[model samples]
Target: MTGSREALPDVDGSGLTLGDRAAIALTEYRNGNHQALGELVREATPLLWHTVRAQGVEHDAAEDVVQSTWVALVRHAETIAEPKAVLKWLLVTAKRAAWEAVRKHRDDEKRRTELPDDSPEHPTSLPAKDPLPDAQVLSDERDRILWSSLQQLPRRCQELLRLVSLADRPDYRYISAAIGMPMGSIGSTRGRCLAKLRTILDEQGDFSWT
Candidate 1:
């Protein structure tokens, strides 16, 4: 774990880079669907891992940096001017976070020497850590509007909707895994979910598609 190593995802395997899929994923995420993010992370975590570790961050700390960078992306996706440049943005952010981690770890070591074991410990001296991945919040106006529409769907429909929308391709097997739907039912469930979503949008006047 201490050694630096790169784990690059095979673009040919997915037929596209994580950044290449960012536009689609962002649209799903803005609608408050986290399944899109799971897809993004699967495609991009390797690149992010390499970037963070390239900064001399140890494996464990680098892992944390990579996670935080993704969390930041979720939080800031709506504001990023170029969605196509998602990978570049993530690498840059991870590098910065890596540097901060290295500096703080070094400083923490130095300060530990200043305080003898008998000295009263001051928790404030420790650097603040980024929130755990699940604790991070993703939001924006578009997210709010989309979420309002999604909320109207039945729970089963919401699950199907999120799975179908975020997947790069319609894989019934995957839907079976994601939502425990039998193969025979996946197609109908997806169709119904989409129809329900459209109906909710129209009824709520969420958006008018020409």
Candidate 2:
């Protein structure tokens, strides 16, 4: 069921900008409004999903890590004083949860194999196959170059740009939450990420995509 906070009026067509609405939601949660927290989670899931995946966690495992992070947020809600800080808390918490899960998986495998802890199985690596469409090798190379350019961004910038690129909400609240920035900052962050990507491509001399 959607939370009571879901009934909150959408601040913009984007379904509520992260600033006022998120701040209110956190305040509601702090005042013992649990449903408000649920609404916040629903609105924020896509950001969390992208955040965990950007850390090299696979889709399924990352999903689990994100959920666990939200659960942790609820448990720690009393301690988090600022609503604006939720996004940052969620991002860092999700990444750490992902790493913790990876570590546990490795330890489990080591115990099963009767090996030293140092011999624990490695986390499954990111898929290495180029995601290029079926095409000539030259086109595939270009695709790889573009993706490599994306990977070169700072971890937070990569997550922000990736989500913003796919944003459907005209108001861009999703983009703001995904990047943990104020609504006013979304436009500038977009420009900065674009500029960084451009510089990377320019440095690599792969202006063919332009």
Candidate 3:
């Protein structure tokens, strides 16, 4: 049930997608190998974070949802019915939890707004905030521009691109399922999204993303 925000390990040449590794991790955990679960946590937490964040959950609540998703995986390790689909399971669980959090926040805000204006609990002013803390820290102007351009895309495109960037290309089907996208067309959809992103970047300036 432990996790970290460390960068994903390079699995190039291993012939294993994140989905495959998730299945292996769950199977190993079921067989009393706890280390695999920890490795999965370290590797997959970023994916979970972004998945939750894409649901419009705030940063702090997204952190809680990600951790709870890992905990739920451990609790249901024996009854998941299909270990091969563990990555999709995690993404779905995190997304549902995020939706719940957003719903609860909206309910609370609604209640607050209904309160009397002079109520002690009523805020006097809206709070200012910085950008989301989980946003990638840009190292230069080009990186910043690329990130800005990314934000200009549709939310679905943003979610797809972020998940694919953090995972193996072979896992796109799992990601597509998690994000409610049609599996058969995810490849073409991703290609179109990338082309659109490149077009946006080009409009910004001649900056090499490579």
| lDDT winner | 3
- What's the CA RMSD of model 2 in angstroms? 7.5
Candidate 1 lDDT by residue in tens digits, 51-166: 45545566678889988998899889777665545555665687789889877876776677654543436533343532222312335444554676776788677655654454
The sequence of per-residue lDDT tens digits that candidate 2 reaches over residues 124-177 is 343343234455653676666767888888866777777765444443554565
After superposing candidate 3 on the true structure, give the runs of residues whose Cα lies further than 4 Å from its correct spot.
Answer: 1-13, 115-139
Tens digits of per-residue lDDT for model 3 on 17-103? 888889778877887999988999999999999888777777787799999999999999988877778899998898889889988
Each candidate: RMSD to true structure?
16.1, 7.5, 7.0
lDDT, residue 199, candidate 2: 91
Please report, in order, the local distance difference test score of every candidate based on alpha carbons. 0.62, 0.66, 0.80
Candidate 1 regions exceeding 4 Å error are 1-15, 113-210
For model 2, give the 10-residue run with minimal summed lDDT.
Answer: 118-127
Arrange candidates, best TM-score first: 3, 2, 1
Candidate 1: residue 69 Cα off by (Å):
1.1
Higher-TM-score candidate among 2 and 3? 3
